[model samples]
Target: MRYTLLGVFCVFLIFNASQTLAVDTFCQETKTLIVFGNGIMNSEPEADRSKNRLQELLQATLTPDEFKRLEFAIAYNQSYGLLRDLYESLKQKLGADNVVTSFWRWLGGRDILPDAVQQEFLRVAASFDFSTRVGTQDLSIHLALYRSKTLEGKKIVVVSHSQGNFFVNAAYVALHSGTDPLTTNSFGVVSVANPASFVAGSGPYTTLFEDGVIAAIRAATVPGIQPPLIWNLTNILSGARTSDWKGHGFLDEYTAAGSRSVNKILPDVIATMNGLQQPPQTVQDGIITATLTWGAQPDVDLHAYEPNSTHVYYAHLQGISGRLDLDDVTSFGPEHYFVSCSKLETGTYRIGVNYYSGSGPETAQIQILAGSSVRNYTVPLPSARGSSGDQSPIPVASITVTGDTTNGYKFDIVGGL
Candidate 1:
């Protein structure tokens, strides 16, 4: 009787435990997101369209939850504006075949431009060097990746099209050279209609035969380029007339419904989203962190003045209590600075912004996170190209900390805007 009672009690206990301990089913936040880099947009508005279309497609394809969690952004390369249209006209006059070949050759570091096309090339390009322009643009791209991965702990996947590939490649090199080896794994690329000899970050890329740009490049250059994905031109054109007449458009050919490029690109992006490693969120790793971002404005500088008479800016990156992590010179800046969490300093830290270089006045937003509180300020920066000690940085806010890291830190923020 005693043995039977013991067995019955054990069974009852097991049943009760099973009923009480229901598994927690909270959804994990997605750490991966996508950023679109447009190629050869004629203007800023066109660049906006390219990125918007990609975002729309992703929104339509991904599950509602997935789409919501997968944040998107655009790295808008300054438009060629009228120069692009002029170049197109020149390409027609000089024969697309000759221009494409020479362009790729020049990009490949070849010193010699064929004598026949050299004069025309220089005239049409108007001394506009793609590589040189992209070199500057890469700084903004590098800062974006750093802000996303190293600061926010998010994985970044860049979907680059045409000329954007060059920017991605350059930015990848910069990011790799500066960051930790493990940090590079936080980035990947999906090259679309790529004209570059190689894709950066070793991610999957797709180019189609119907893409006249790639076709012209292939016919003119050597065999280093990836063979285009074969697709029936008649079928594609007949189905939809949305793509560019030359079939080199990002929205019309590559991302459009039933497009071959999308077949490869979507899966590759999803795989990368799953495969990339997630780093710990370090945005708040410091006791006081200030991040400044602006619109199409080229250069916006972030400055942090510590109470100890130490100033941290682009010129002086490190201070006694904090350091400037990134300084952006190209369009759409995210100049970032932070006070070390370990080296908590109890004093007044002034946060300042400077409209270093831009076309006109720009609205700047700075978010300062300190002691579990975040304060955001939006201030219109005048069109003034301020350098080190030449023009005073516009004071945004001041934070006064009162305690050490041992017990807990207290923050008193004073607005200066």
Candidate 2:
């Protein structure tokens, strides 16, 4: 009896020691990478499967070096949340087939005035319960960060998409609200296709997120020492982008084929992940990307006119092959345009710029990329002092895709991002 008791005590000590060692190991990392999944994606068994799948997707697709750096944890599972509730409610009311369709159509701000059928669906989606879910998601993400008590002072970065953006912002507010931004440098958030108005808007899909959501995201734009960059990669313009299927799809990321699929969204993820440390390695998505940065200009716009004579500026956002991924006016400029060359008609694609606001002749550093070819253009973007409408754009450079290579299109651009 004495021997058995002593053995049990020894085992208990070993278990506790192992657990402590595990936590210490986790804390060794300088920062934490947390991924917030999509709606209907964060439930028990599904969440576990999705988490594993997400990790596997990243591991499989990301370069071996990138995969090595991909140390992430699941912050929240939304399987049983308010969005799920809305889904279930919609399913019952309009049947499963129409739920996603109606929601998406309404979401993209289409066909609302003529069809009264979707109004009820919108009402249901924007109900009180969804608001409660956002609150719950906020706390849930906060808990994920706080639970790692061993890593108390480590910087936290949240990778969120779609509705997850709202949750992540709420979590940021919860975590860093009363604290000193300069001191803790608490955390940074990366949001994709945030809808920007999810929690705030009403009426239609385009105006879906009203006041509250807008205020929250606008607040997020305020530059912090830790960098509060909101990565809003909108349309993919190719024949049904990976996300266009669900509209909000390809929006969480790291997945192989879902809306925020790794292939479609991985490039941006690569840029953001390597943003803090070593230089980023671009993802090979067969698309030409131009990212503009002018420290002096707060609101400069990027425009890409295709060989097909279609323009993709802020006004005509969607084109034959590419889309204006983001139009940043409120903060430092990183206005971008991504072109899936598969849809290109084979000619010189004209790249232009508009010095939208805050005075220019601003030295704009433009980075253009296609496959392995990257070039940097330093141009003096002329100044414009007026309303948002008069964007007097100037044609800056061009990318000529002579022909096709094995990897979609063999192309060379005038500039790098």
Question: In terms of lDDT, which candidate is strongest?
Answer: 1
lDDT by residue (249-337, candidate 1, tens digit) is: 67666766776566677888888777777766655334467888788877888888898978889889888878887788886666788
Per-residue lDDT of 1-417 in model 2, one digit per residue for the tens? 011221121112133332433211010112335454443323443444545655676677766544543445555534345555656766776677876666545433343422333433344323323334567433532443332211223334455544555566566556544321223443555554453333211111211112223223344443442222233333343233332222333322224353323444455444444453321212212246666656555777777878898878877878887777567776445567766534545688888676677754676656665544555666675666444433445656788865332223346565421
Question: Global CA lDDT of candidate 2, please?
Answer: 0.47
lDDT of each: 0.64, 0.47
TM-score of 1: 0.53
TM-score computed on alpha carbons, candidate 2: 0.38
TM per candidate comes to: 0.53, 0.38
Best by TM-score: 1
For model 1, where is the 10-residue window of minimal lDDT? 1-10
